[model samples]
Target: MQRPDDVRWPVRVARAVLHAQATGTLIAQYGLVERAWPAALPAVPATRLGVQANCLTDVGVRGMDEAAVFLAEHLKLQGLPEAGEPVERLSAGGWAARHAAGEHSDADFCAVIDAQACFAGAWATARELVSAVLESGGPPRSPGALLYAAVVAGGEANPPVPAAELFALAGKAAAREADALLVDLRLAAYTLKRLSHPPGALGRLAGLVRGTGDAERRHALSPADAATVRALAMNLEALALLKKAAAAVRTLEDNLAENRAGHPESVGETLSIAAYFHYREQDLTRALELIAEAYRLVRRDGAPDRLRGCRKIAVAALHCGGRTAEAEQVQLRMARDPLGFDEEIR
Candidate 1:
């Protein structure tokens, strides 16, 4: 439950590797793992070693071949013979070779494929993998695998299956797996896409959000520790449940203010969402204040998307407050470069 850096070296290294694996940006993930790789040497847990190897393999496929080969050789030197082979194999022959070898569990294979699709943007490969699995009489049943297949089936541009049917199948699988959270959250999101503010779905989603926030508090996890609260807030916003969304945002802001959460990106996003909420409520002054703080936090890391989001909220609030010229300037700056503005809006 401690922060990644607050832990002992081994745990810190593992946490960093896991965090890298979860990161949305491949470059950032690769950098984090590359830096943590040295610290993971000699005697880390076998599980962590395997995870690091897998991560390096993923990065290598995405164009960081040197790191992958280096990690494989380093693991071999550490006498982790079992750990190095998969990296070497994956690097040399890729996921197909691994699948042919029949060594990986179905769950592991599905996870790797899912990562390829979600993180590496290999949708075609994902579809291929899913088809192969199905043809082999093994339709993905694990929650992660099912979720991935569902997303791919539903989200693609062309014809394969109806989005609604796939989502319903996924929801059922999630329910059977006792993953109440996923079922509720996934179904709520899917339903939202189909219908605007269905009362029953919104009610369920609101409860899920409240329940998750409560669970986080009970476990002493800062609402900002995971993306759960932030995601819940976004879902609420999508449902037009502003009051509940604002409550979730306040939890994130309070955790950030108390120094309980260290992720500035997450806090920045929550703030931006809150700013939009205030903007919707016609509190232009509060909207500007919140978005200014959000912009400041996001600019430190050059998060262009978050910066763009903050800019939109700030520009709207400024324009609505009779500062059209300032809004135009902000819009122009964002158009030039989302992260070019050095000064946060006041």
Candidate 2:
């Protein structure tokens, strides 16, 4: 909803928060927070809903127990909880007692987990979210779960749900057709996406999906390439977080053209990711083509790290395109030792 010229503080924060989550990019707890408002501390969030949204995001990422406490008090001061009926009351003992007694399916459960996750890791919160999704009478609500998953990514994701359930439920949703597919569980995918060191739990989940090789791909890029990777990933994350997948495709298409003109090498990386969006759009042919181009560039001119990453991306693109054998080959190449190279792709 941002205009080219009218982009401001609130939009930028909103964009950054959503982008961070969508790409599974882990924003560090103490990551340098750049202010978009330029010395003005008085900046309203883009929308009224953003008031709570931004506050909740900060609480989870920074582990601001004081802020969480303040938020609870402020809600009470406003005659909330009962007044805010659906918004669960911030009663630590009461909530915790319920949680211990396995009564976490309450509608307000995700909110409670979101608040407590400010102190605790996102793993337990994720587990609770999964529980909520499993228990939903109707469909999964992707946004709320998406928000929590991204916020939780600022910390480690220990994935509280049994890996098997995560694999079964999540994999089924990923494979289903547009109509029959569970849209809400896409948030579940994002939560799992945030898992970096998915040794046992994630490894097992990867195993559930026949030969997708989705989880086998590790990040082979180096610290030197971090900025560019972050930029592209954040860009995609923003679109996904906004739930504007189709529009995101158009936006990224324009961005890819601009980047291609300015930084030719960057096209491959951006295109590789654009392929992911295309895959989401159910355009496997386009996705494979874009990824193939990226793979060519990375193999020819990419640095050692980028080559490895591009290979991994190629594998992902192929898997999404249902070209599993080709994806495996790419994975094998990615696993090979570098041929001695180092340079920024963008």
Candidate 3:
């Protein structure tokens, strides 16, 4: 199949983001090696977590296409043999085979993992892949990558390892390969993210926050790193005390231009956070406006989940604002649009 031009950069990025997240979820649910290497991921203690392959059904086959594109793009960007490339596909069986061939360097691995970790959906599966990578014997090509994989792996394993413990382990293992301070800072960022979400690792996040600010303030992150930090912050908002989470959201918005130039996903996230906050505060009018903004962005980009979320919020906001006619129209349109009715994508 022919690939679309990148002229639609924002939509492409958003699609890529969605694809990566969905792929991660698939890995977490079904176990990455389950179909191919049934005993692999499951044999690991972390396999105790049930990762239903069925979850991908909702995201649909496009999710897999996006995943393939993501891996292909990463491989090309890293100068590794992309499995999707005809010659490379024959040689590597595809991108995964090329990756397994040890042709990738530390920087290559770092770039891949960094891109992979940007989505929440990818968190669990990425963690498993990283853990397995850590146990793989080699002179440790990429310490930063190793540290990242270790942190993610620890998050899903049966024992449910603490980010801190993983941080320490990563520090000890990768210290000689990279600067301990840098490693610590990166570790701190992921720790903060893990704490900010459903499982709520507040204590760890709190401990990491102070020192992380010190390090990050002094260092400039790559554009990709900036995006990852923002995504992590979004996840963090849920786990943080309301006040702190609110403040973080504000900071994320303040720094929007840094990450938003060509990335609608980041922008949509900002809008979603703003909308969610306003909704919770009962400022339904403002929430409605922001949700509308979010819907506009996602709809243009083919991101159904964002649109669905915005639609739900907008309906509530319209009701609060007593704009019954507009609310009804929105509902009617939603019911009529086949794309809008994809509850699975929602």
Judged by lDDT against the true structure, how good is candidate 1? Answer: 0.49
Q: Flag clash pairs in model 3.
A: 24-122, 29-51, 29-52, 30-51, 46-157, 83-94, 83-95
323: Cα error in model 2, Å = 3.1
lDDT of 2 by residue, 34-135 (tens): 221211122323443211223233311332233233223222323211111122222333434454455643334444343333222223333334444444
Report the number of the highest-TM-score candidate: 1
Writing each residue's lDDT as its tens digit, candidate 3 over 1-346 gives 1222211122233344334444552222222222212211111122322221211211111122233322333324333212221211011122223355677555554433333332213444444344444444432345555455444443432424354665566577654322443345444444444333423444444443444455456564444544444444444444354565466546555545544665544566577767776776777866776777676655543333445567778777787778888778776666554233333212
Ranking by TM-score: 1, 3, 2
Model 2 segments more than 4 A misplaced: 1-243, 300-305, 320-322, 337-346
| Global Cα lDDT for candidate 3 | 0.43
What lDDT would candidate 2 get against the real structure? Answer: 0.40
Cα deviation of 26 in candidate 3 (Å)? 24
At residue 121, give the lDDT of candidate 2.
Answer: 23
Tens digits of per-residue lDDT for model 1 on 1-346?
Answer: 1112111222233334544455532233123353344433313223433223332112011212223333332333332112221222132124334444565455665554434432233444445555555445445565555655555554343425454455556557653322445445654654454344456556766776676666576764454432544454353444455456556455544544543245433455567766887787778987899899877776653334556778899889998999999999888887765432466653
Write down the lDDT of every candidate, Cα atoms only: 0.49, 0.40, 0.43
Q: How close is every model to the real structure, measured as TM-score?
A: 0.52, 0.29, 0.46
Error of 2 at 285 (Å): 1.4
User: Cα miss at 134, model 3 (Å)?
Assistant: 3.2
Superposed model 3: Cα runs more than 4 Å off: 1-128, 139-141, 147-209, 212-239, 243-267, 298-303, 322-325, 328-346
